[model samples]
Target: MKKLPIILSLLFLTLCCVSCKVGRFVYYNLANITDYKIFPSRPLVNDSIVFHYYTTEQDKAKVPKKINYNGSEVAFDDFLADNKTVAFLIIKNDTIQYEKYFNGYEQESIIASFSMAKSVTSILIGCALDDGFIKSVDEPVVNYVPELKDNGLEKVTIKHLLQMSSGIKCEESYINPFGDAATYYYGTDLRKALSKMKPEREPGTEFSYSSCDTQLLGLVLERSLKGETITEYLDEKIWKPLGMEYDASWSLDREKNGLEKTFCCINARARDFSKIGRLYLNKGNWNGKQIVSENWVEESTKPDTGLGNVDYYKYQWWLSSGGSYMAKGLLGQFIYVYPSKDLIIVRLGKNYGEVAWPELLTSLAENY
Candidate 1:
């Protein structure tokens, strides 16, 4: 019966193999908790966070002018009905004429911006450039975040990363459980998660969206101003200066630093978010203060020099052929702006993954 020991060992080995497979899956799916929640409330307004509120007089003057558009009311209703559009705001000529919050949402409710944060990053870059904190977009990314110097990603430029052409291979499917995007979120340190990737193409050659590209940009921002974090920089340079009326919160990494460069998760009042768009509409000038340079605004909105369509991507912001630009986030979070029309629209919802946002935009464009 010596074969009994062999059989038992085989059984133990099989069990161990199965356990290891299960453990790997768990590792891939599980996210560590520095802090996490399904629908977390945003921080209250104070010195750390502030919101921009419209006074009664300002509100009266800021109402939008009516427009004659060809889109049907029924179609819009259908969009809201079928899609999980939690918040929608339409600003025309720097005024709020149409604003709404659905799905148990309110005026002060904080919603995740998802990738919309990238546009915010673009603005921060503009401010840095305007302040002479950063010399140019064409500078090698390693110039800011020196730790990336020896890595293959050293070839990537700030401009390339902004345009989503950093040449890093990435899969950005959030719905897929085992996807790289999902795996990155599950990691204990999302910032460090990016350094594990390899460069797949020549920097600025083709368009391939990579969250890691933006994460690396965050690293650059963190390194740029000595020991200052991105959140602190944004608060001093952007958020506080704009006089945001809400205390917006950003999800952090293991280092407790704001992931400012991409996958935006700031939660602010609808009007506060619009203020940012307003700042851009005015070419980075805010209340006589040039928070960011006029030249930087012009360049950020322009098309990239790389392979992709200039209309599709512009300095980490997306500009349409109609001269309109947007802060687009996954699941239908959008801060849409049209300079010619003086229009700014903000929508926060879960319809992005399942609904056709482009179709809605087309209808709105044709109608408005």
Candidate 2:
């Protein structure tokens, strides 16, 4: 009977170890929090692309040290400090205006894009549209993903996914281990993970932010190409043409033929990420060559009326009241573009305190 006690003790230790591991995983993800970091990403190489350098002539004009925030004035220095900003860059008229790096981050350091990858994925969809791989944004997702033909997902279209109005029942809670977001982030089989999802409402009826919409779009992109990997397609179409200075990486769910975590977690340099803004600012023309269609650029950035009352989201890009669009990621990664002023601002940081960024950007646009 003494063996019963020892067996019970062993089982308890095993359970404790398992619980500890799970706890560590949740703590590291911190999906519920706004200040979590994305790590352990895979490399997305840019081998054939020649480096394209931005014309560098630093402007010495001092940015405003203070701006209004929530009926109170807040210093920009304090904003950076309180928000744990690691890098801040500004490019105006194709010239580097102000550039600074903090927290030991250098120009060459690769940072995670978190949800900014959604914008990139949307760009890929544009490229696919241009290539005729995708006939139109109005096409049903089930047309490409035959597995979802019988499911209720057939009602969803590419436009709905891009606008985050797919109406899928995928909860974007990162903290819940059993939630759809966690499963898509950590699960091994993305196809299986996506296949199980069903629409909770009529597709495109209302706007709802869910990462699963983007993942489904990624699958459609993959299936449309028939056999091309997203990394390869990205390198061939955008990365090479945009003249990216550094190679970027996209994280995958598994090692062999694993699907990219397309909804988030693209690792790239701050400067290279700015190229995207430049592309849109120039109306999809890069160095006199058209990359993405001008029509697509206009359609993607402007607010979609189909999203109902939500005017902030448009084709995976975030829209502001001033008609300026931005690519934002978790934990304060932002690439703000103002085409009217030929201005682009890139901010990479660990966290951003509750500061009025739109007001700050607008002020900078007006002043500069």
Candidate 3:
């Protein structure tokens, strides 16, 4: 009978070990959701978290017969069902051919953009430069945020931040509880968290993807615009000018800062997000207006670094195989553009676990 106790202990240990490994794969940290304090609140649009609204503008483009893609084939409906993808909009040539929302998602629901907002911020930066609000990406970041002038950040260039090449002391290991990503999200003052960082390497010497880099860029943009908010800049440059049907909102820190330009939580309609892709595909032109310089658009989408080519990040967009670029966010948010193919696809979802967003995107692109 003494073996009974040992057997029970062994069973408990086995169960604990099994749960830990399974939890690692299925559990979502979702620290940003909690850290941002985005409790259940009124959405900017409709009540749902995913929806679509067709623009009044007539469709002026054609649909492609077939899409080019790499990797294995996947059924669109099956993927949507299995992944719990909140929304999907496929624009081929120029007309939207396929759009669906699952799991009670509906039109006018403003799903959070997460990291996709970074690419949107990049577009706004291009507009700010074109309009002479900021002279160039080569300008020292401290020129705008004078508080950073004497700090080590003074040496960091705007381009460096955009390309995620800022050699700041940042570690983005999401799994590590003590890592910068978790600490930054959990902290009340994200900028204060950044302020505490001492440079571990020279600015722009190495490539390291850091959400703080984009947040700092947000601060710089706000400073350049004379304390104008990022939402204000976006409204002027893209949202209102592009004829966005409804108001979009950004969740901010405790200070009510409107410049959470990175790390997500942008609440906007699916169509509005799709417009961003269309704008890039059209080379920054919107309704006969040069919203952003074509030169900037071209340069911002091309691969800039040589460290690795598997996924080349340009500005805030990621360049994939076959001249495709996209703004991708955690949990499957995407704003993909293929200028050569004249295609754009915007997918928003909460598939943090149990789904392959990249693979699903590849499937959509293949069917395009």
Winning model by TM-score: 2
Question: Candidate 2 — which pairs collide?
Answer: 44-249
Provide the TM-score for each candidate, comma-separated.
0.79, 0.87, 0.78
| lDDT scores in order | 0.66, 0.78, 0.68
| Candidate 2 local Cα displacement, residue 326, angstroms | 0.6
Q: Worst 10-residue stretch by lDDT in candidate 3? A: 39-48
Q: Residues 322-362, candidate 1, lDDT per residue (tens digit)? A: 67787887667777777877767777775553556655554
TM-score of 3: 0.78
Ranking by TM-score: 2, 1, 3
Q: Rank order by lDDT, top first?
A: 2, 3, 1
Residue pairs in collision within model 3? 51-106, 51-107, 52-107, 67-368, 114-264
- Tens digit of lDDT per residue, candidate 2, span 25-95? 45455542222133334455655655454565444544556766667778765666566777787788777
For model 3, how does the per-residue alpha-carbon lDDT over 1-368 read when each residue is reduced to its tens digit? 99999988876775564323222222334433222234222223322322233332324433233332345355655556556677877776556676777777776676777788889888878888877889989898878766665566777889888888777777876667556765544444556665665566777667777887887787777777886667666766777667666667766654444235355567776877898888888898976988899998998888765532224788888887678889987667888887777778877776644565566565557555
Clashes of each: 11, 1, 5
